[model samples]
Target: MWARRTWTDGDHGYLAELYDRITAPTITTHEPILRKAPDLSDAWWDSLSTALDAIAAVANNRVAVRQEYLDRAMPHYLGIPIDTTVPAWTAAHGDLHWANLTAPVLTVLDWEGWGSAPAGYDAALLHSCSLLVPDTAAQIRHRFAHILGTPAGRFAELVVITELLQTTTRGDNLELEAPLRARLRFLTER
Candidate 1:
């Protein structure tokens, strides 16, 4: 479903809207709470390193989250460089995974957490989810790199942080919590 939707800018925007609706609390309400609690994973860390490299390569700039602010610190902790002063926005499907998409026929499900967000957010999400399977993750990253005309280094880091942000804000779902934590720690550690 995403393959087809990727072709239409309108569908992409709509998907972004849906993702925002579902995951609104994380960005708007719960981020502060999660920052204080330290819970994270090894797999998430591995993925975060890759993600950070990818973003750095694509943006061609050093990315760091703001200091003394949890919300800002979190993204930087996960290797996504965000400048509070700069306006760098793009439509994002806050949650984009195979479970949220239908195969055979293209239909993207789960449109609750959509919104305008950092660049490469969707690609990062897709790559992070693919991490569950090594081959799958490699393929996804490769495809993303090809599509974006860049390497998939920091992409996973961005996605992991994004996931952490969501899990922290919204009530913890057992399935997502573990992975999100893992990713969070992975990115935050020096």
Candidate 2:
């Protein structure tokens, strides 16, 4: 079992970390990000929900996300005012993007950024990742409506979009730049 460890090289300084691998035959949420939507069963989503619940229940002393950080960083970085009022905070896979999640049998990967965040933050980020595929995005929305429809959920969505926009501006994920800009404008226009 890999109990998260950090390493620093004595040379040019870097640590290669390792994780106990999850099951095989799993396709990442974004490996072929723009590919046609995967055939998923309702059972898969149910398992995903259960896993997210379990992860949220885990206790960690580190504050991966701070209220003040969100209050300050988001607006200044995105040039969009935010609703600083946070309604709920729970353990979140902070970088909940397609590349980090696995399909068929759901298995969330990437733990480096996991931390307490706005409730439904994971769902919002995942949904945003699916924007390239409308049907998949809609399905995600339907499944997580209870969370995504709330004001706090919308705030989480904004954070997700802001991050995508910032990444785009950095010349990364250039394919998403246009769509992410539109999404950011749509969310902030109200």
Candidate 3:
């Protein structure tokens, strides 16, 4: 799932090492949870909250995201705030999840979405997916806080907002109607 960017064998090796460094600890600590519970948990919610907070902090000081195609499809959708004002950069998987990662070997397979993104984007994505399992979601959240060194409360509001946005966007797809509706209900009820 790597993108069109060509990589030499050396680059691959470096990436592999980086992946191991980033994911090994979490994987080692959480593989059991992944294998057992795939649904979202209270813990996952907490982790998502923390990640969103970090994103919002960074996003608040940056320029707003702008994309013509996304705007066309979601005319009312406001783009996320991204801090382009900073000169720092970090490599991101763009999309990180259990499916793209392997245990024991600690390999991260998919790389299509890899690029420079805000801090904690990968963690945010992982937390988002972890919501599919309640217990694991909790574990993921706990791990996220440990990794990012942020308080979980910092992210709650923004995570809810982002999840709402994602739910609304997915509502257009018939296959996703039920889950999206449930998420919408959850958002509204809260």
Q: What global local distance difference test value does model 1 have? A: 0.44
The runs of at least 3 residues in candidate 2 whose Cα sits more than 4 Å from the true structure, single-residue gaps closed, are 1-19, 29-34
Better of 1 and 3 by TM-score: 1
- State the local distance difference test value for candidate 3: 0.43
- Tell me how candidate 2 scores on lDDT: 0.73
- Best prediction by lDDT: 2
TM-score of 3: 0.43
Cα lDDT for residue 158, model 1? Answer: 47
In model 3, the runs with Cα more than 4 Å from the true position are 1-89, 146-190
Better of 2 and 3 by lDDT: 2
Sorted on TM-score, highest at the top, how do the candidates line up? Answer: 2, 1, 3
Per-model TM against the reference:
0.44, 0.81, 0.43
Candidate 1, residue 48: Cα displacement in angstroms equals: 23
Q: If the candidates were sorted by their lDDT against the true structure, best first, what order would they fall in?
A: 2, 1, 3
Per-residue lDDT of model 3, residues 98-129, tens digit only: 66654443455555446544455566556545
In candidate 2, what are the lDDT values of residues 1-190, reduced to their tens digit? 6554555666555444666767744445435244457677898888877877776777776555678867876886578666776788888877766666666777777777788888788888888877788798888889888778888778888777766777766777677666666767876777
Residue 158, candidate 3: Cα error in Å is: 4.9
List of clashing residue pairs for candidate 2: 30-98
